[model samples]
Target: MLTEEEKNAGLVGRIIPINIEEQMKTAYIDYSMSVIVSRALPDVRDGLKPVHRRILYDMSAELNLSSDKPTRKSARIVGDVLGKFHPHGDSSVYDAMVRLAQEWSMRYPLVDGQGNFGSMDGDSPAAMRYTEARMKKITDEVMADIEKETIDWTLNFDDTIPEPTVLPTKIPLLLVNGASGIAVGMATNMAPHNLCEVVDACCAYIDNPEIECEELLQYVKGPDFPTGGLIYGYDGVREALLTGRGRVMMRARTEIEHTASGRECIVITEIPYMVNKAEMIKKIADLINDKKIEGISYINDESDRNGLRIIIILKQDAVASVVLNTLYKNTPLQTSFAVNNIALVKGRPMLLNLRELIRHFVEHRHDVVVRRTRFDLRKAEERLHIVQGLLIAQDNIDEIVHIIRSSQTPDAAKERMMERFGLSDLQSAAIIDMRLRALTGLERGKLDAEREELEKRIAYFREVLASRDEQMRVIREELIEMKEKYGDERRTEIIYASEEFNPEDFYADEDMVITMSHMGYIKRTPLAEYRTQHRGGVGVKGSATRDEDFIEHIYVASMHATMMFFTEKGRCYWLKVYDIPEGTRSSKGRAIQNLI
Candidate 1:
């Protein structure tokens, strides 16, 4: 007889047979799909994942947390979301909320958080109970008109409440906010773009649906990171925009400033997005310690609320450019964001290029406009019916008064008015319910004016619904409005970047013992390797040379210190200790003539 576990695994009475290998493969695939769809990837429409969407919706709709509303404790919002909609851990919900609030993280932060959210130094945000959060004004645009039935809705995880499948965003949030995620066998990292640049590019694409990515590049140069940095590799950006994938190099913007002591300091006022200032300093210190980089004498993070300032003091006459370049090469000061524009498109994951992304946004805008217009039209028509009834009652003031006074009940008066005025049941009800003050001259005139404006607006909405060009015009106008209000200068700058850079940078400026041979051979070995011994102990041989060549001279210097050389011809030349051929204590050195 099989064990209980084996019996359960294998075919038993009323049990179905299946291959274990196939089941494992299928289960893993299913789990991967679930993670990719529900956890990692964002929707192309709103540029938000399930958890993010739930938090925003719960905050905005359920909690009535608008941009102007008083901020509520993050713990409350997190708890509500976890209990009602998301059904996820409190940390995940709070983290998503925190990222939405962090200006360093999101190009356009959705949440207006009070108290400490976090810092660019990669500090953790305050506890949920400690922080307060509310929606930002622009997030209104993201969740705009959602209540007007502009987008599809889905039941929550528990099937108790309905939630929007995607937000009815006014702008192309995908480009504006960007996204980053890593899933099984795949990952996505979309760099944020400038609001103005993105809007202009979107409008350009709208004008010419066949517009190439290069043409769009005219409007949108490259990624506009929230934490401003100097972007290089324009070609890489263009390729990413065109093909949905490429790597754009980012270098921290730094200025070489003169300190009080007249020493030149590399002041890093800005850095690449997501680089922690504290960790970056530690990394540079590590590089200096490990003999991987040279010339940095001291590093201090003088960052404050005013702005980020990481001061890297250099040695006297140290090549600032070389030191900066070395820092860029070895640290997070220079980084590359790999653009993989993957997002969920209509419940399926898809990689979209620039034009496709713009087109999706424009299409969503058009759909939203249509739904909004219809909803508005229905509301205006209903109000128009009530207003028309009021106007009719105002016109027949005597008859309405007589009918109301003669009837014993309100229902009898409503029936009599409907029969006499040829009004619909709703119109008759409005007439019977009319306030006495509404019959005044001012009220009648206000009603007439409202009626005229409603008719005019209703006609315009119909026209917009009828023509695609008109719809596009509205999109263009709104984009321009958004640009005028929210758009600012692009933070990240793109320049032509050469791919090839020196691989070998300066190492630690460590003390070393230099030795030369009569044959003009030279070598350097660490000074520490020469051990101190009793007077009777012979000095350690620091170099190996040819039989005919003996050690003529030795000097103690740092690896980065300059070495002056005088030839027999009375000519002088200089070389750094690192420039000399490095050799072990027993290794013969190479000829200096070959090195120079």
Candidate 2:
């Protein structure tokens, strides 16, 4: 088809319309793939992405591996990584490095960088090349294994650089201290766990591969965030671990403190993880500025080099309970972390249940063990074959010497021995190499012993290979049992599991006074005070004054409303005072009415 404009210009233009829906879908798919590959997917061992892993590796390579040392300028490390391995700009890399080193940011720091890598006070780090960098020992050890081919590798965008597909983590990092990331349509926010508990769980799995998830829970109770808040309920933790989706509640710590100035203050020591310190401080300041709080003189952040010490100074007469309640009602002091994502097997995005993640890791480890064992077995078999050949030629020293001196290669010598002795390849290779002259007299026995050891190892390898499936099945069954026992969905709210108690002495005396009034104000008077002040009233007897006078008090629950009024004359009336003008006095009258 051709448009009118094409006809006017004496040219024909074909019109091929595109399906907008199809185009949009294609674009979205591309975007999602980009996010999944570039942003998420923690390397199994190091538990970090390309950029994060590179930053740590570069820091370790440049800075001294000690947090105790004076911190290196962060800029220096950023420059090294960007210039060498990571092609990203200095600013982005530096920001990420600073975040990792900042204690307030990450639950567990992968880099122990020193200097002003920024502060929890919303401070940014200095420029790249100015701030020095160093790696934490944990990062160093983890990355060191990378060079040993413990993990797979893939090419970079240009295929000029090689990057690890995933790290060969010796530990179950997913549970040790969990991870969080957002990629494409998926995101991850696993909670940090207790180190001791995780180690125990891993050891349990190893000892009895058939251990159930429920049994494992006995060792690992629940996620233990570094922030040290109560888990409230374990159901969410269990669900997230099991199915990789749940929520958990967290609350800030607050306490009442008596200041040296003879006034009270509310002190906040710890905050929830990832809570913005600057924003929180500003919010509190706004509350004070608005006069929403009573008797709050000032708010100060005494949080210094020592630690976090947010002090809310109160007026000398302010009620502490009211102040505390106001804080809870107003701020992000209490929040919840929603966990609903998973990262596993490098680039493969799996919706992991707690049991599923553990199973995946176990499977990977099993593969590694099998591959290592096979490699070991192959080398041992080769050595055993050579020893067998030497054993067969033990009596023919001259012939063996002739074969060795005459043959041009190890294989050639073995072949000649095999034909001359009418022996198998293994026997021929063993005899050709087992000559005492092949080693000094002292080492000859040692060589023979090594030959026997190699033969035994080969036999063992064959036996293990034959029983591999049965062993793996046993391990898998044990892990499944552990998961069943401990893996459960989190019920975030608190649960109290006990019967209610009723006690005879539960009731206490009520010191409260109740009054019935038709007006907004009800007056109360103490007898002793009234007697002392109104002793000379007309028509009042001396004994009457002592009995009837009371201290003056008023209770006004609300203004402009009908009130029920009760009087000393043993009368009651309902007064409609909602329209009564302020400062007006009512006639002193008493009336009584009874319902029919």
Candidate 3:
């Protein structure tokens, strides 16, 4: 809307003004799209970002180092991927590769490292030069048929090489080994699951696509962390599997036992996922010194190559179970994992729940299988053509030989054979160049047998390529085979302990006297603790009081009852009677306000 006067004022020579807010919004949107698409999020089909896929593809295609091959130095693979495909920092590439090699980080590690790749104690991995890595045996399921044009490819950073947009993975990589990434304005933290369970659920879905997530949960129970612990509730797990996000609570597996000195000790056998052992120990020590925790005498880390053993010694007379609960409340013994199952679907970020994720993987597998079958059928048909040509030449070898001998040159013989025998150029050329032994009846039979086998294989491949059911069957078969070979038991044990071991579950149902004294003292004593006496005789002290206070209120209740206390200001506090302090006839009770 500028006039000729503004244009003449030197505003036309790149000094034109635009709305700063609009430009900022446009730039931010562009950057966010870039991050979500090309940088942070993983593809739903392959469950890997560009860098991870590029590293694997570079190892498989460029270096030709498969699972069976000898491991190469990590630096070589990182340098190749950076210079060729991922044009990023070497440290980023190395860090990603190291995570793939870490068993503690991934439930099913994609790379097998020969040297130290770090530990659950927050140790740093060795330098890329010091560590050698190769693809795991299971990675073959992802890399299989990648060379058969089953997946799409794009130009590398320099355009000198081509990299796969996604791998043709048969295994459900997303579920087996979950993903975590932070992009612009969004992030993802998917929980890992058991391979066998996932495969079972996949088979079930293939059999019945109408099965919902709740039904699928029967086969696939919940997340299985590599460093095994215990999941407390199933509600969160169910919510996460049904919806796209939920928060599941996890706790360390600890065993408490009484020593010869009559002291209880906690032996930590396994910790929650991703909780640093050294850091956790240091934190507990700090809490003990700060007097934020009671009953912990000392902590000693007895971890070694054999296994992890963290010993937490307790002071004498400390309630072991109570102390355990306190630790769970105060320390990192219990943690919550947020499940945000977000991934890129067709270059767009999508929040997918369990069922949709499985469906996507199934669809991807179908395409890969179809493409591979087509490739196989094409090659089979070509070989079938050549074998049929040889069979035709064998049927009339003497005549062909006479024609060849009479001809002046090989080209003339080829042309004569093509014209007289109605053979195509390829068939005619193959006949002329046929081996001498191939003229014998035995060789003829061998060629015929090969042709027959190729026909059968071609028919099968065609059937698979034509039928969707056949493709799904192939997927199921591969899944079962993978389960037989590489599947492991679930590591993270999901316990309905919250439903089973509540505050009242530890005690039996019994009548009790709930008493509140005038001095604000409250206690619960079993009715059986009282003895029968004469009506006017002096009875036992109802509750021992120090401030000349008497029992002002009394109520008969069960030990499993819930008691609510109302304050003068109408503030309410409630607790189970089992949580109330037990008092004897001669003991002064605890203050109700303090107890509540």
Better structure of 2 and 3 per lDDT: 3
lDDT by residue (1-596, candidate 1, tens digit) is: 88999977776577768999999999999999998998999888788898888998998999989998999999999999998888877888998999999999999889999988988777888898898999999888888899897999889888999998888888788998999999888888888999999999988987888888778878888889999988867878888999999988888999999889999899999999878888989999999889787777899989888998889999885778779878887799998888999998887889998888888888888888889888998999999999999999999999899999999998999889888999988998888778899979999999999999999999998999899899889888988888887888998877776665643344656789898888888889888788988889887766777778888988999877888888789999998888887789998888889877
Lowest lDDT 10-residue stretch of candidate 2: 504-513
Instruction: List candidate 3 stretches off by more than 4 Å.
Output: 1-17, 260-262, 398-413, 432-442, 497-596
Q: Per-residue CA lDDT of candidate 3, range 266-323, in tens?
A: 9999999889989999999999999887878989999999989999889875667767
C-alpha RMSD in Å of predicted model 3 compared with the true structure: 6.2
Ranking 1 against 3 by TM-score, winner? 1
Best by TM-score: 1
TM-score of candidate 2 to 2 decimals: 0.65
Model 2: residues >4 Å from true position, as ranges?
1-21, 41-46, 53-86, 140-150, 203-218, 230-239, 304-306, 344-348, 378-596
Local distance difference test values of all predictions, in order: 0.87, 0.60, 0.88
| TM-score, per-candidate, Cα-based | 0.86, 0.65, 0.84
lDDT of 2 by residue, 1-596 (tens): 98888785774345657899999999999888877777666644346777786776555544454444565667666666776677867777877777777766554566776556777667777665656656554454345444444466676656766666655544455665577788877787877665556555665666676777777767766666554544545666666666678876555677888988779888877766666777888887888888765567888788877777788888876667666656655665666678764675656776766555566666665654455456668878777766655555554666778988899999998788777877787676556545455645555576689888887888877665668664465445534444453333321223323222222112122112222234223322222222334656563221111234332333343322345656678777664332222221222111123210
